[model samples]
Target: MKMQRRSLRIEETLVKAFIYFSVICVVFALFNILWHILSHGVGLITWEFISSYPRDMGRAGGILPSIVGTACLVALAVAVAAPIGILTATYLAEYAGKSGVMRAVRFSIDTLAGVPSIVFGLFGFAFLVIFCGFRWSILSGGLTLAFMILPVIVRTSEEAIKSVPYEYRECSLALGATKWQTVARVVLPAAAPGIVTGIILGIGRSVGETAAIMLTAGSSLGLPTSIMDPVRSLSLHLYILVSEGVSFEMGYATASVLIILIFCVNLITNLLVRYMITKRMGAGAH
Candidate 1:
């Protein structure tokens, strides 16, 4: 009894130490990144700077165009990819594509997700921009990004659809409802939250992507007034700032914005998810 008690106590101490170490490590890294960004970006985050246009060496320049371009690109990618991704996910999970051709399609999607971003960029450049004659425009890049994020959204949404309570599906089936009716009415409602999560993740990935957009989308640092215009995204801006070393200050400013934007997006989604879960649980209880 004494030996067991001693062993339990030791184990408890080890677990506590492990937890503390892990938390401290994460905290340290977070603080380090924030500190670097704050020290550089705080002074540079003026409204004027945000509104102004870019100039040589970044000493007296702004990222107005870049910011706008990034937003438009992200929006375009999301709009194009969301519906396709959702449908693909629905088919994958609900239908599972029994036929040989459908199976091949599913296999291709799986493979696409695993493919490197650089290769996607290459394909986009060659096919979408050159041969297809879209040119190095925002439209092409946004489309490429949409294609790249499709696999992610589809896979995540498919899993979410699958995780819906089997009882809900079974009850719908028993009600003389067609598969489509059951899926649209019962399955979709239950899986809506999860599908949204996948879209959010796809957006997040799209916003952060650099290499793929770089090759496919012309990063002109100019405002994307139209879909055909060559534009720069925030990630593209970040890459540019880091690469040329023309201005470390701009790098810091851009990094800070990117971090803050990502945090806010994630936080809002988390709050929405929590509220949804709470509402669902309350409804279930009643």
Candidate 2:
């Protein structure tokens, strides 16, 4: 008995040490990357650099067009994907039960989650760009990104909905509420944070994507005035700057901006999720 206890204690200590080491390694790597980006890029982050348009194939001038394009693409992708994903999740969670259709849906979602981003781009190119006549434009890019992120949103939302206590539904129904009423008023509000977290993740993916957006969106340098107009995203812009030897300094600057933008987005999403959770907790306490 004593020997077993001693072995268990040793195992516990080893596990804790391993976990701490992993955490330190992650933090160290993140800090190193951030430091390198800031040191190389901070000098180029002038107001003019951010506000001006490219002058010579991105060798000079700013990334205003890229910034605007990235924003528009992300917004459009979210608008297209969120409602469809949420509704699909709702049906799967609340109504599907243990049917064959439910199984098929879950399998399809799993397959989608594993599909490569480049494949999604190819599919989008073949279908939306070629067949549907959207062409190489913001609309094509947005729709492509929407399809890419749908699996993540649907799975996250379904899990969130499933996590809601059965008692909540029972009580709502016992109070003479309809099934739809219980879902909308009781379950959906509880799952909003998780659903929104998935949306934020999708937004991050949209912002960071390069090959997919480039294929569908066409890397035009000019500011896009309509969904039909092609545009260059920040990620694609950075890739071009570095790949074509346009301007290494500007490439680093664009990388820094992309990092900062993602960080800000994640921070804001985290705050929103925390606020939602806290509000829910406070309501429960009352």
**Index of the highest-lDDT prediction:** 2
Q: Please list the residue runs of candidate 2 whose C-alpha ends up more than 4 Å from where it truly belongs after superposition.
A: 1-20, 283-286
lDDT of 1: 0.85
TM-score of each: 0.87, 0.90
lDDT values of the candidates?
Answer: 0.85, 0.91
The sequence of per-residue lDDT tens digits that candidate 2 reaches over residues 123-195 is: 9899999999999999999999998889988988888898777889999999999999999999999888888
Give the clashing pairs for model 2.
none
> Model 1: what TM-score?
0.87
List candidate 1 segments past 4 Å from native.
1-20, 97-107
Residue 43 of model 2: what lDDT? Answer: 84
Q: Which ten residues in a row have the lowest lDDT in candidate 1?
A: 275-284
